[model samples]
Target: MLPQPSGPLRLAVGGLTSITDDFAFFTYNLCDYRRTGRSDEARYARVEEVIRELVRPGTPTVGAVQELPGDDWTSAAHGLGHLASATGLHCQAFTDGTRSAAAVPGGHDCLGLGLLWSAEVDPIADTLRYISGGPLWHALVMVDLNVGGHRISAASYHAPPKAGRDRRTAEAGLVATTLRSHAGDGGEIWLGADWNSPSSRTTDGLYYDPDPTEMVTSADRQRWGDDLPEIGYRTDRTPDMIMADAGFRDAAVEYGAPWAPTTGHGPNDRNGPRRIDRILYRPAAAAPGGVA
Candidate 1:
């Protein structure tokens, strides 16, 4: 069952990647992602700080959070409770990942995609589904919302990686089809995504490696075209292109790049950051509105 936080959500979309579901997966990435990632607790603290500072006090928020934990650990419910307690706004999380106990070391009991939203967001009942069919990597969460008194449908998506370009395109197409269905039923659409590929927002405009066989000669690379295309793609297109064709605005066109790299630093110089996380939407046809 998808979460339907009790209240109203405003018209805005936000997305962030790799936030561990609570600290449940902390032990899994203690050395590699915890300490080596950001000096111990600093990474977790930063995400909390972000929610506290950016989410604010009296407005609705729609966050498409990637790398969320499954319900077995109580990540989504508790995460929503935490946000509500901190900001005085209703919050909830929705994910399609199943609840399973931890099966491997350095892994969470459950891990997948989710939507973090304030009660005002109004998620449609049973609107959560796995993209690219059942049991895939990402989930799509939808809300049939009324913003500025206009009924609309909004969605949060997390697309697969660059190597799986064609599949990601198919997933984007699925999302597009869904959005079109909503529109045909008299609803407009908005989308937020951790698209995992380059756009006009990325440091590089193109998404595909241009040449996969030469990029990384692993046995998997050799198997893309001849074998499972799901593992990777021999050819690809930028997800932004697909979203644009779907009639959503690339937020990058308005927000520009973040002032600095989003990750990898030794106290100062940042690594090559990419603008893979983004918001896309078709503005309500009647009025030009701001992200409130």
Candidate 2:
């Protein structure tokens, strides 16, 4: 009998920043080298160019991306179609952007989430979840795939800004629950999100406080609700813990390597360079959805 294929899948997850709200505010900051993990002077003149590089050929890689811009449902679908053309990774459930855009808020001239997968990966199904009460509200994109001889469920999420950790925490919980319900018996689920939560380090290899309690404003308390874990009130609070409890491991923290800050202000800036994005996943297992 032929030996089974060996090796891990090459996956990339990131927040591309909003074309209208975020990127438009800072047009000159399109140094996409971080996402490509390469050093190139090429700027993000068009979203398709960046998408093209994120999942280049020769390697079986998939991308879970946030903030892929689409002005409406048709455009949203088109935006993903463009990525698929550039990377050769088919976009699941991609019809005209016309219909899917309406159910999701940002499709009308705003950023949206997406999944880009390699050819060997067969798309099983996909769905979306709209998150409210964050610093910014956006829909979450989830996709299930069978690749590398195993089933996988993947999702792309961008949480509210750091200004609202309480809300971010709640969003994390919802994401976790969704994964559990969909995970079924077993393959594995990797939920990648631009969590916007601070880590203990910065891109320049410097230490920083991970305290989530920097600004627990009165309004924040109301948003946090009365009952929550003690860590929820800590200065080091992050949505990772919630996902951890949901039974997933942060690939960055587990591997001890992280991509540079995809999009953020400088060290002195309020939204400084933080490796807040991550690939949260369950260990290899066998089950229905492969997400035990």
Candidate 3:
């Protein structure tokens, strides 16, 4: 059994892309949205220190992390080690690419696996079906670290809007399928992502909707066709709605507001702000973190 800590365990899901030396990209707690990718170690270290000092202690956070190696997989592992060591935060990073660590990563408490699928039409449908239709979507072989008596299995992904509406809908369907597969479950599950759904909150002056009807530009229509079914078409619309249908509760909804703002990556879109990146929890046998 894992050592059950007395403090709260907080899980954070966000985007981290290392672009160049000293220039990096971050969303959520990390500042500058963009930074010198070369100094990711320094940048992330500072961020971790701030989080540790400002936020509650013993909060295990996992974000969508990217590592590009100038050499081989070994170099990648070394890079990851540097990040964890620098921050004094033990972490496990999972990436399908050779740039990931030597050890496998998965689940809530431990390093977790990351899955990526392309939008090529021929294999897209098959890939979606396989991941969601079985235990693969909720696979949590390594997340058993928390002593909370409840396990948290999480999956993070980005939907392909440029792939067209039909393709996007199919992907959303796969998300729905995964939710169904995990329904009536005892463990906790969270799916996080920058899903460019039609009902995304509007902000600033950039009126954007993932809706095909509103996207009448010839180029956009061709890319996002009219035939595809947008699971929901209003501001309240989202893939979470599908999860709700399958018995999951919106974690943000529990607070009557979202945790962050729209476009976790792009410029802050709204004057009022909105949260597109979501955290959904499956009904659990017992509360994991203890009453939010």
Candidate 4:
């Protein structure tokens, strides 16, 4: 179950001296370094290079990252610290959601979730919260930030890759509901995630129409069973739909690049190509031109 807010939480104020309305948000699924052939140093350097290329100087930026190399909090913090140094951003690692206690090695908690933000953003005191129960496959880290004097609720999430549609839908529902509760009416919210599912609706074949045979395999069928398609692997867009129904907008689609692929690059192309990683946001209803 998601934690409920006890009362009106006070918003943190006035720490940023160079606050700006222009905010740049990004999400990335850094595949577990242990599974790849690249050395830790090489992988870290590549990640830093990619992020630096993506970030625009002088703009407030927030990056939500998944699959950070770490089995425990100490290791994850160390990894996040390296990223912070490389990217010049403040960092925080989400506790491993796969575990009932503090983040420790030896389960599905090997890969972790994290958040990185530029100095222009101020995180509210006691606002950092994690989703408990529902046994989320990966962590969902949520925090409230004072961005240019506007209170915004932001989160980083990574949905289960091997779970069934029902499980994924439930997880998405949990995330949406929890975010809405934290944001309240007319508040802005941002979520960056690797949903491990397609963004296109089943009925819509215009955007993404990958050959199911190339994506799904016998192993997938044996694992997911009835949750998969009768012939091949297909991710029903129910998870993304849940976010849409909650009033969040897919940032890529909104920016006119709905078909841009975020995954299945290089050696990780076993599942073909997909736009699974995303940055979704809900603008404040009362804001004058709205915040993205």
Candidate 4 Cα outliers beyond 4 Å, as residue runs: 1-21, 33-38, 92-109, 132-134, 163-166, 201-231, 287-292
Sorted by lDDT (best first), the order is 4, 2, 1, 3
Each prediction's Cα lDDT score?
0.42, 0.48, 0.35, 0.61
Candidate 3 Cα errors over 4 Å, as ranges: 1-55, 59-83, 93-147, 161-165, 179-184, 198-238, 258-260, 264-274, 286-292
Superior by TM-score: candidate 1 or candidate 4: 4
Off by over 4 Å in 1: 1-42, 71-89, 92-110, 119-135, 162-166, 183-186, 200-236, 254-271, 286-292
- Candidate 2 per-residue lDDT over residues 103-160, each given as its tens digit: 2224212556566666755566334334422334555666566654556666766676
Model 4 earns a TM-score of: 0.75
How high is each candidate's TM-score? 0.57, 0.62, 0.46, 0.75
Runs off by more than 4 Å, candidate 2: 1-51, 54-56, 94-109, 125-136, 162-164, 199-236, 258-260, 264-270, 286-292
Worst 10 residues of 3 by lDDT: 117-126
Cα lDDT of model 3 by residue, 197-268, tens digit:
533333344333333433343223322233354423333354445555665555444433323444433244
How would you order the candidates by TM-score, starting with the best? 4, 2, 1, 3
Which candidate number has the best lDDT?
Answer: 4
